[model samples]
Target: MLLISIIKTALELLVKLLELSNEGLHRLLSDAGFTEQRAKCQQRLADWLQGVARVLTQDGRQMTGSYAEGWANSMVQVNGRTAADSDIDWTVLAPGQEFHLRGGCERKGSCKDATPLQVKEGHAQVAVGAGSQPAVTATACGVRPAQDTCHAIECCSSFFKNRIRKLLPYNFDKVHLVRATRPSSTNELRVSFSFQEKDIMRNLSTDQGQLFTLIKFIFKRHLPLTLDTPGLKTYHAKTLLFFMLEKNDTHPSIEAWQPHNLIALLKESLDMMLSFIDSSSSPNECMPHFFMPDAPLYFKNAGIGGDFDNTKARVRDRLCELRSDISGVVEQLRGLVRPLQSEKFYFHPFTLLPLTAPPAVTEIRKGMYSPEMYYKFADVYSVVHQCVSELQSESSDRDTLMRQLSILQQLQWCKCATLCMTAMAHLKFGESEEAERLAMELQRHHVVSGLKPQDIQADKYDEPAKLPEDSDWAWRFCLPCDSPPRFPFLPEFTQTLFTARLSQPLSSHLYVNFRCLSWSLQAELLRNRAPAYAFDHWIKELLGDPDLEELLTLAHYSDCRWHVRLSLQQMEMIEKERRVAMETQDEENIGWVRQKWWRVSNRSGSGSDSGAHRSSEDEEEDEERRLWARARLGLVAMETAAEQRDSWTHTKVSWMRLQ
Candidate 1:
């Protein structure tokens, strides 16, 4: 009895040791990021084992009484199957004796004797009668198919049997419960489920074990070392936060799940993204072929509009803050970099589609003058104009210039051009003074260059010149001068040229010939008379073409009609010259007279007697007397023809008939 008691005490101590080991293993595993519910699993298993052991001890001597005696009686029911009657018995069920009950088994001797049961292949018999009416046999039921199994034992037992199915000692073809042994020195517990390939695949498909595996891999193997790398800190933090948010829809789910050094890392990442956004050039600059107005709506829709005035106000405030920050950075950069003097710096304008006036302009106006800021605005206007010009040149399908002009007209630099064009448009409406004033202002700034009035007098000359009613002939005359006197000749010559060009077909050709002749005659005449006047007049006539009069008139309309008065004086001078040349009777003098007469006739077809008549008459009367008569007659005929053509032509013919 003492030896038996000692053995029992040793066994009890061994059981206690096992329980303590199980408890320590459970605690270690739980602390290792294992499921916390696993503690309840361990406690339940211990209770089950203890119940099995107590039942076995109580029924040890009653094996012959019923199928429930001894180990068979202590066999736990699993998944609705009695262990003794199950074909695939669990390892936890001990070998037991089979008992058969006869009919009316209230008599002790009526029941069959006990036989050692083959726990693997035996059946159980239950009493149903007093005599040996063949014992009511109950066939052993095969272990419930794994699919119908839900008990933790069944799951574990199936897992164990599958793992070592090919091994000899475990070749009973029955699932068995196996407990993992604790390592001798370690306090940590490792609980592993041996799942079949199909079970693993199913669990994976459902994402059941994925979260746990990821957590284990990250915390156990990846975290500390990954966090140690400074370069990866921000990236990993953002990734972790993104993943955490994705995993749980509820924000509270991640409230306790803090990544290592996450806050600092997130702040760094945000700063980096912001820096990238600010420093990167706008898409418009990078891709200029894209029309700014037609750029994606996302850029347009980025800010508030319409009734969201409050939101727009807040956005403007934020923009002001951002601008200030950027300005500080730019100043620092400028100080450090010291850009080349000729290098152009540009700022992109803030363009709002469906533009609303910005309120920040008021604040900006209060700052001290900055040349850089001034240039920035100027550059924006310039770039916009360049873009407008480019678009206009390339495409006729769109009115890009007009649209850009409309937008830019509000700006000061662009306003000049807009005002100039507006003035031109106003000119057609008879606001002549307004137009001229605006034009002058525009020209002063070099906004619009080289705009002057245009002469309307050419239109008046479209009809042919008409003779006065009392005139004997219709006469038009042009005096071609090489270099005429400034006071009298230059102005007359310019008027004749203008009139001839407007009324006569041979004006241009005659003007050239007369210029050469006039220069020779004037040089000779002034050789003994006013040389300075001659030189000055030569310059004036040479410089003043027909266009000069028209240009002056168009440009300065109120200027006097100097050209018309000069023409009358030139006619009188021609009469005087003819008379003086006649008395001289010099052929050279007559040649000058003939050339002048030709020019006059070519221009207006209204000059006096032809040079042929003057030469013939001078020869007939010893040259001098006949020349005088010819000169007098030429003068009279020139005046008559200048008056009217019909009577003059008839009178000349009648004189010829009389001769």
Candidate 2:
């Protein structure tokens, strides 16, 4: 009875302890921001613990009864206190709290196996008050008490940093807001960041779109300030030009400034920038160089609001204008020469000689010459010479210009080889012999002076020499004859004493001389006869000795037309001979001759123009000849067989009579 009473007391104490633990769990939930929804959950957990404590108390009282003895004997169950008394330890699990076992746990430990608590999806509990259920809200902690909520601070800080990043060009180490009072206005906000200009420009230039956007934004805010700074202006100009060249947006705001003024400003900027490039240094030594090898030519004319089509047209016009200027300069220089030649008094910055006395300029300026002046003269002379040469046939002014250019070249004032060639080409249209003579003279002079001839005879003429036949008397004299005879002839024939030596016919030597003469007189005639004669001579020589069958085979493999023709002619001759033999009834000659003829004829048919008709005609002739030859031979064999049979019959009759 006393033990029963002790068990009842212990049960009441356990019940009180469970209630206290449940109350503590509710308070913890309220603190962790799960307050409003956790109240009912807390009540249910409290009731469950109360029922368990009541069962334990009732079972303790039943331990003294007979039914309790039977149940305990049947199950052999031990109480929690007895289990704790053995070697095992018990750990109580409270609601809303979990213990994590990192490593494997032994069964004898105080901790029991327990499943982890799964936090509600998309919700995290944040502690707000001590006694109320904890506030449950989104994982980002959107709901909480005023003092405890950090959402507004976090969001505002992130937004501030993002805006700062957009405004600044470089990465920032840290970004924050600090309150400070300003003189102009109180409670005003300002974003501050630090960056390096070099790094900013490097990043900007690498990203074209970003650079353009930044530039456009800056220009929009800062009006009336032309991008004229030393380091920055070129990049700005390049960006603007790229847009204009690609036909992108041409903002009208830039048009308020004069085009001429903008060009002048850009020119000045470019010149200043170029001047900074040291003339003595290599390109690699120049810092911040941007021009590529194939970079397009940029001029001051491509300024803002400058029409691109008009600019290109203006460039062409400027070239034409330069031609006129160069022509005028040449005229002025020519006039200077006249005064110098006439021994008239003159004063000019170009002339080094004093003009106080007669012949002073001409006499003193004989050997001395300036290379720079010569280069300029050459440039102008070439242009004038081309213009003149093109128009020489139509205009006398152009002829006079050509003559002036020739004089410049002859005086060694201009290295105008191309211009001279142009003039010579133009002159050749009317005076071919004169052009040829001049070309020869130039070649001879180059050879004498040990200089390579700039122009060769073969390069000047596209057509080969076209000597007319000797039958045309007028053309014979019209040919270019050398002053000194090219071939030696007998001199003073009337008073000559001739001696003759014993000699064989000079046909071979004469033929050789004739061939050389023909080649020299006209290259076209030589080209025409060379291939035919070469093939004919080769075949005649090769066929003379039958041992040249390998060469013939090679020729056949080459499939040249000459070889094919020769082979066909030979085959046709053989076939004709065989046919003649058959017609004459030459039986003994037919078989061997017919076989050889057929082989040659078949081989001859493998030629380019050996068409169906030609092939069929050859085949038909070969077949007819072979048939006739075979028929004639067959008749002869039949006659021989009949004669043998008659002789055998006579012998048999003689033998029978003798028997």
Cα lDDT tens digits, model 1, 1-659, are 99999999999988655533423322222233222122122222222222222232222111111111111111111111122312211122223421222211222342334331111101112222122111222222111111111111121112223322322222332232122112121221111121222122121210112222232222222323332211112112222323333333213224322332222323333343234334434321111101111111111122324223332233234334433333332222223221122211110011100011111111111111322223323233233323323332323222443443354444553444344333423333445556555544443332111111111011232221111112111011122212221211221222222221212121111111223223332322232333302333433432322122222221111111232223323433433423111112122222322332323333333221222223333344233322332342243466543443344345445534654
Once superposed on the true structure, which residue ranges of model 2 sit more than 4 Å away at CA?
1-379, 382-393, 397-402, 411-419, 422-429, 441-659
Count clashing residue pairs in model 2: 13
Worst 10 residues of 2 by lDDT: 140-149
Q: Each candidate's lDDT (Cα)?
A: 0.26, 0.25
Top candidate by TM-score:
2
lDDT of 2 by residue, 1-659 (tens): 99999999999988655533423322222232222122222222222222222222221110111111111110111110011111111111122332221121222344455332211111112222122211211111000001110111000112223332432334443211122112222332211111111222222221222223222222221111221211222233333423331232223234322222232322333333343333313221112212121112233223334343443333234334433333332222222111111111111111111111111011111211222222332233233324323332343454554554454343321222323343244443454444434433332221011001121112222221111111111100000111212111111110011111112111000000111111122211122332312444334433421111212222332234445545444433433522111212122222223233333344554553332223454556445443433333243366654553454455445534644
lDDT of 1 at 158: 24
C-alpha lDDT (0 to 100) for residue 604 of candidate 2? 53
**For residue 466, what is the lDDT in candidate 2?**
18
Question: RMSD for each model, in Å, please?
Answer: 50.4, 51.7
User: Each prediction's TM-score against the native?
Assistant: 0.13, 0.15
